[model samples]
Target chain A: MGQEILAIIVIMTAVTYGARVLPFLLFRNKRISGVLKSFIELVPVALLAALVIPELILTPTNEFTFINPFLLTGICTFIFARRVSNLFLVVLFGMVVYWGFDKII
Target chain B: MRVKGFIYGLRQSVTIGIGYAPVALTFGILSLKSGLNILETGLMSMLVFAGASQFITIQLIGQGATIWVIGITTLIVNLRHILMSFSMIRFFPGISLGKLSLLAQGITDETFVLNSKLLEEIPTPEERSNVALGVNIGAFVSWVFFSFLGAWFGNRLNINFSGFDFALLALFIVLTIGTVNRQNITTYIIAGLLAVIFKIIIPGKIYLLLSVALAAAIGAFLQQKQLKQNKCQGENS
Candidate 1:
C-alpha cells in the first residue's frame, strides 16, 4: 500500500507539474488572440465563484436551507468583504460568526 | 541576485504559509484518519499543494476508489490551473527551467492570486518571479509543516468545527468585488447565474467544471461581439 501510494504520488506530481509548466512553454514569445486573452482574464473570477458558491450555499442534505450557518456567514462575508477589503478580517469575521452560531445552536 | 529573489520569496511565503498551515494540518489529520501514515499525508500535501483536489482525492481513496478514477478526477478538477498557468506565462521569460519546475509545485489558488496582482503592480519579469517564488515557497513550507503536525497529533486534537469551511465563500466574495468592472459585470452575472443553475440541476461533482466551461464560452462569445461592435463604431466615427 505504501509503495502504491508513493507511485500514485509520483505520477500525480508529474502530471500536475507538467500542466503548470506547459502554458509557459507554449506561449513563450507568442502573441495570443485578444478574444482568448479576455476569456482567460475572466476565468479566475468565474472559476473562483463556480468553485466556492455552490459548495457554500448547498448543505450536505441537498436541501436549500435559508438559515444555514454557512449561508448566513457567507452573506456577512460578502457584505463585509466589499467594505473591508482585508482578507484576514473578512475570513475571521465569517469563521467566528459561523463557528459561534454552530456552537450556540 | 538570487539572494534577493529568495528573500522576497521567503517573505511572501510566510504570509501565505501561515494561511495554509491550518488548512493543510486539517488535511493531514483527515488523511491519517483515512489510513494514510504521517509520511504519506505530508508527502501528499507537499506534492499536490492543491487543497481541494487533495481533499477530494483522499476522500475517494478512503472509499476504496481505484487509482485510475482518482487520477482522472484530479485531472479534471485541476484543469482550471491550465488557464491560470496560461494567464501567468508572461512572468516566466527569464526564469530557468529548473527553478520554474520547482516553483510550479507551489502554485495554488492563493499564490496565483498574489502573483497575478503582484505582476500587474510590478510589471518587471524578475520581480514577478521573485514574488512568485517567495509566495509559493512560503505556502509550501507551511503546508508541509502543518500537515505533519496534523498527522502527528491527529488523535489528540478534537475541535468539532462546522463553519470554517466558509473561508472559500468569503474568498469568492472578495474576488468578485475585486474583479467586477463596467465591461465585465454583465459577463460576471451571466457566468454566476449559470453556475448556480447548473449546480441545482447537475447530479454530482462534474458541475463545477461544466458550469465554468459553459459560462466561460458564453462570456467569451459575448465579449467578442462587444469588441467587434466597438471596433466598427470607432471605424465609422
Candidate 2:
C-alpha cells in the first residue's frame, strides 16, 4: 500500500513539474520573435479567463442563476481592484460578499 | 539587493499564501477523511502542489479511481503551466538551465500574475529573480505546512471560509484587468466567448487549451495585420 502511494506521488510530481518547466527549458536560450512575443503576452489573459468563467460559476440545473459564490465576489474583486488597486482589500470584499450571499441565499 | 529582493518576494508570497492557506487546510482535512494518512496527505501536498489537480486527485482517490486516470487528469489540468511558463520567458534574462528548472517549478497561476507585474514594474533582473525565489519558496512551505495541519486535524479545523476559495479567482481577475487595451479588447472578448462556447461543447480541460490556442491565434493575426497596416501607412506617408 505504501509502495503504491509512493508510486502515485512520484508520478504526480514528475508530470506537474514537467508541465511547469518544459516551456522554460524549450525557450531557454532562444531569442523570442515578435509574433511569439505578442502571442505570449496574450496567453495569460486568455488562459486566466478560460479558467474562471463557466468553470468557476456554473448555471445550476439549466437555469440562468449565479449558483456559485463567484458572481458577487468576482464583481466585487473587479470593482475594488480597479478602484483601490489593493489585492488585500479586493480579497476581503470578495470574501464578505461571498459569505454574505451564503447566509442570505 | 539580492537579500532585499528575496525579502520582498517572501513578503508578497505570504500575501498570496494567505489566500492558499484555507484551501490547503481544506484539502488536508478532506484527504484525511478520504482514507489518506497524514504522511500520504503531506506527500501529495508536497509532490503535487497544484491546487485544482490536488483537489481532483483527492476526490478521485475517494471514488477508487485508477492511478492512470488520476495521473492523466492531473497532467491535463496543469498543462496550463506550460503556457504560463512560456508567457513568463519574455520577462526573464537568459539564465542557466539548472536555475531555470528550479524557478520554473515555482510558477503557479497566482505567482505568474505577481511575477509578471513585478517584471513590468521593475527593471532589475537580479532583484526580480531573487524575489521570485523567495515568493515561490515561501508559498511552497506554507502550502505544505497547512496541508499537514489539515490532515492531522481533519474537518474539525473548519472555520467556514467558504468564499476564501475565490481569492485565487479574484487575484486572476485583478491580474487580467490591465491587459485589455483598445487593440486587444475585441480579441479578448472573443477569446472569452470562445472559452465559454468550448466549455459548453467539449467540456473539460480541453477547453482551457482550445480557448487559449484560438484566442492567441486570432490576436496574433490581428496584431500582424495591424503591424502591416502601420507599415503601409508609413510607406504612403
Candidate 3:
C-alpha cells in the first residue's frame, strides 16, 4: 500500500505539472499573430464564464432551474458586482443572499 | 522594489487565500478518510496543488481505480491549465525558462484568473513577475498550510464549512463581471450558454475546454469582422 500510494502521488504530480507546463514550452519560439492573440486574450473571460455559469444554473442532480439559491445568489452578485468592484464585499453579499435563500427554500 | 511588487501580489492573494481555506481543509479531511495517511495526504496537496483534481484523485483511489486511470483523469481534469498557460505568455515576455517552469506549477484556475486580470494593471515586467509570483506562492502556502492543519486536527474541529464554498463561486462571478465589457460581452454570454449546454451533452471536463475554444473562436471572428468593417467605413468616408 505504501509503495503503491507513493507511485500514485508521483504520477499525479508529474501529469498535472506536465499539462500546465506543456503550452509555455511549446510556444516558446513561435510569435503569435494578432488575430490569434486576440483570441487568446478572450480565453480567460470565456473560461471563467464557462466555469461558473453551469454550476450556478444546475442542481447537483443536473436539473436546471433559475430560482435555486445558487443562481439567485449569482444574479444578486452580478448586480452587486457591477456596482461594487471590491471582491470581498461582492462575496459577502453573495453569501448573505445565498444564506437567505437557503433559509427560505 | 521587488519586495514591494511581491507584497502587492501577496495583497492581491489574500481574498483567494481566504477562499481556499475551507476547501483545502475539506480536502485534507476527505483524503485521510479515503485511506491515505497524514503524510500522504499532505504530500498530495503539496505536490498536486490542484483542488478539484486532488479531490477527484482521492475519490478515485477510494473506488480502487488503477494508477493509470488516476493519471489520465488528472491529466484531462487539468488540461484547462494549458490554455491558461498559453494566455499567460503575453504578460511575461523575456521571462526565463526556469522561472516560467516554476510559475507554471502554481497556475490553478483561481490564480490564473486573478493574475490574468490583475497583471494588466501593473506596469513593468519585473513588477508583473513579482505580483504573479506573490499570488501563486501566497495561494500555494495557504493551501498547503490548511491541508496540513486539516489532516492533523480535522476530526476534532466541529465547525461546519459547507457555506464557505460559495466564496469560490462568488469570486469567479466577480472576476467574470470584471472582465466583461461591450467589446467582449458577446463572448462572455456565448461562453456561459455553451458551457451549460455542453455540460448536459458531453461528459467529464472536456466540455469546459470545448466551450471555451468554440466561444472564443466565435467571439474573435466577430471582433475581427467589426474591426474590418470600421476600417472600410473610414476608407469610404
Cα lDDT of model 3 by residue, B63-83, tens digit: 999999999999888887888
- Which DockQ values do the candidates obtain, in the order shown? 0.54, 0.62, 0.69
Residue-level lDDT of model 2, residues B141-237, one tens digit each, is 8889999998888567648657676666776777677655787776677777887777777745567778887897788778988998999999999
Which of the two, 1 or 3, has more lDDT?
3
Better of 2 and 3 by DockQ: 3
The DockQ-based order of candidates, best leading, equals: 3, 2, 1
Question: Which 10-residue window in model 2 chain B sums to the lowest lDDT?
Answer: B154-163
TM-score against native, each model = 0.86, 0.91, 0.94
Error of 1 at A7 (Å): 1.5
Candidate 2 at A92: error in angstroms? 1.7
For model 1, residues B46-158, the per-residue Cα lDDT tens digits are: 77777877888888878988888878777876766777777777666766666766677777767776566556666567677777788778778888888999999956877
The digit string of per-residue lDDT tens for model 3 on A1-105 reads 499899999999998898888987988646787678888899999989898989988876667988888887788889999999987788778877777877787
Clashes of each: 2, 0, 0
- Best candidate (score: lDDT): 3
**How many residue pairs of model 1 clash at the backbone?**
2
Off by over 4 Å in 3: none
Off by over 4 Å in 1: B1-19, B91-94, B160-163, B200-204
Q: What is the TM-score of chain A in candidate 2?
A: 0.80
Model 2 Cα shift for residue A59 (angstroms): 3.5
